[model samples]
Target: MTRFSANLGFLWQDRPLPDAIRAAKAAGFDAVECHWPYATAPGEVVAALAETGLPILGLNTRRGDIEAGENGLSALVGREDEARAAIDEALAYAAHVKAANVHVMAGFAQGQAAHRRFVAALRYACDQEAKRGISILIEPLNHYDAPGYFLATTDQAAEIIAEVGAPNLKLMFDCYHVQLMEGDLTHRLERLRPIIGHIQFAGVPDRGPPDAGEVSYAHVFKAIERLGYKAPLGAEYKPGGPTDDTLAWMAAYRP
Candidate 1:
């Protein structure tokens, strides 16, 4: 069966994280994911999840100094300690929330120095989280949307994962970014299946609802199921209007 997770990061931005979890549950999401949830108390998040009976799929490491325009901490060349701390913080929060995965964000950086830092951070993260049984994920953002980001392609991420050589490390494959950056979505999915830990989607270019996207989600979802992907697909898109208004597409794929 194909399951969906409401991305509380973009959806229900008007509400608090706990309230957003409730909103996702009310809207019939099978699971929930968030971009960052450090501001919300883990107990409150746990309470919401308990009440709603919806599991949190995952959460992301902090993007350092957002006011300074830093997108993440992991790959920045001189910030190894800060990046490792961010990983620890994310893992700690995920432990409290019982989230299965944590995305270690690779902030804006480039070249060999940035790659070395990213691999080192992942090594530390993987070693620490192995005891907790939580998976560490790396996602490649599209350059158009995330200019100058260090990780900008699926192949780059795959190579990093291989170089890191951690069993707990995996890929967070976002279909929206993949479609925009590299159009061979199904082929990439198949090739990266062994390392893919999660999947997400939104409309290409517009970043809206998935049903009207340039890529056909119907075929994509079917391919995912046929490939034996058991994880819930994260709906990581901006709503066209109110969050609820963009959910008509859910009726078709979500039971």
Candidate 2:
């Protein structure tokens, strides 16, 4: 069976944050991930991990306006200091959670300076994270979802990762966003799987649980496994209702 990581930030969100970690563990998930344990301190996140015994597969630097807007930090044009701060905070958080990867989102806005700054800031984070055994993930949010962002494709992210040339710096493979931005999922995954430090999903079109969504997770997960992907398949999606109810799709595939 494909190993799965559920994002507790979306599941059991109504409860106190740490309890969400326990909830994902209770759901039989192999790991728990989050976009932001923002208000939740590193001590708290680490404590939750200890109590639940769930590995934190990954997490992202704060985008700042996810509740009011959708543009992420890496989407910005010339705010390298901001990126550094965000990455530093996330790195500390990653350390506490013992997470392996931190997804970097370029802030949304257009300017050559932004691109340069983004790269410079990324290199800084990459250097620091390397010492801590964490891989810094550079994710390309789809243009529709984050217009004006500097990097918006796997190819672009690959270029930056190559330039940075750090073993700890890599791209995040988000199946839903990439499928929405560009198609040919399996072939693409095969082509870029090497630099991919993480993976995620949501059904295409509706971005719901895989059972009702457009992407054939059965096919996708099979392809991923065939490619020898060894990391958790990060379940980063909005719940259809509550977390457990949304995960009922996993039942149909029971062994």
Candidate 3:
């Protein structure tokens, strides 16, 4: 059976992170993940997860200086210090919360210099967090949603993972971005199965609930199961209305 993880970042934006964790549990989600939870005290999040018994799958590194239009820091050529700081902060927070993975964000950058910087930062992260048994994730953002983003395709992410040469380093295969950037989801999933650390999905183009989308998640879910991916897939979609109102799709996946 396919299990699901509510992405607290978009699922319950109106509530506190702790409250969102509770909501995900109540909503029958198997687990939960978030974008940036730095503002919320790790103790609060830890307490909520303890109360609900829902494991947090992962959380993202802070997007540096949002006001300056910087999406992430690790890939920018001149921001090595800031990038390492973000990585350190994320790994520490993940450890405190008992989370399993950290999605290292690669900011808006391009060129060989950016590539080298990103690889070095990822190496630092993988080395630092390996002792804790935490996996480091890198996701490819679609060009339409994240222009100039350094990592923009599965091929690129796979190549970088190879270059970094870390067992704990893996790819975050978000279906929405992959479908948008490179069609053929099933084949890609098969080809990249070994390196896939996590998977996420949303309605393409709209980024809404998965019930209505260009890609059929029902079929995709079957493919994922066949690929032997046992983790709960992340439901990282916008609700369009109250998140509760958008959960009708969950019934189809439940017993």
Candidate 4:
């Protein structure tokens, strides 16, 4: 059976983070994930997880200076200090909340210099999280939604993962981004299965509920299960309206 995780960043925007966790539980999601829970106390998140008995799968490192159009810090040439600080902060928070993975954001950058910086940052993050049993994930964002984003393709991410050479370093295969950037989901899933730590999805073009998407999630979920990915897939989509009204897609995949 396929399981799903509610991405609280989009699913329950109106509620408090802790309340959102409870809502995900009531919605029949098997697990939960978030964007940045830094503002909310880690203790509150941990308590909610305990109450619901649902694992928090992953969270992202701080996206530095959003006002300045900065999406991430890890790959910026001169921001090594700030990048490591974000990584440390994320790992510390993950430790407190017992999150299984941290998606280290590689900011808008290009060329060999950016590549070198991103690899170095991932090495540092992977080393720090290894003893804690936490994995480090890198994701490729589509150009339309995240123009100039450093990580922009699965092939690029896979190459970086190979260069970093950390056992815990993995790829976050977000289907919405991948479909926009590179089609052929099932083949890519098969080839990248070894290093994929987490997977996410939303409707193409609209980024809404999976039930009304260009991509058929029903078929995609079967491919995921066949590939032996037992972890709950992340539902990282915009709700379009009230989140509850968009969850009819979940009924078809629930165990």
Ten-residue region with minimum lDDT total, candidate 2: 70-79
TM-score of each: 0.98, 0.92, 0.99, 0.99
Once model 4 is optimally superposed onto the true structure by TM-score, how far is the C-alpha of residue 239 displaced, in angstroms? 0.3
Q: Write the per-residue lDDT of candidate 3 for residues 1-255, one digit (tens) a residue.
A: 899999998998999999999999999999999999999999999999999999999999999999988889999998999999999999999999999999999999999999999999999999999778789999999999899999999999999999999999999999999999998999999999999999999998799999897988899999999999999999999998899999989998655
Q: List the residue pairs that clash in candidate 1.
A: none
Q: Write the per-residue lDDT of candidate 1 for residues 37-100, one digit (tens) a residue.
A: 9999999999999999999989999999999999999889888889888999999999999999
Root-mean-square deviation of Cα positions for candidate 3 versus the true structure, in angstroms:
0.6
Residue 94 miss distance in model 1 (angstroms): 0.5
Per-residue lDDT of 254 in model 1: 57
The RMSD (Cα, Å) of candidate 4 is 0.7
Q: Give me the runs in candidate 2 sitting further than 4 Å from their true place.
A: 65-70, 74-78
Deviation from truth (RMSD, Å), model 1:
0.9
lDDT value, candidate 2, whole model: 0.80
Q: Which residue pairs does candidate 4 place in steric collision? A: none
Q: Which sequence of candidate numbers ranks them by lDDT, best first?
A: 3, 4, 1, 2
Error of 3 at 13 (Å): 0.8
**Sequence-dependent TM-score of model 4:** 0.99
How far off is residue 105 in model 4, in Å? 0.1
TM-score-best of 2 and 4 = 4
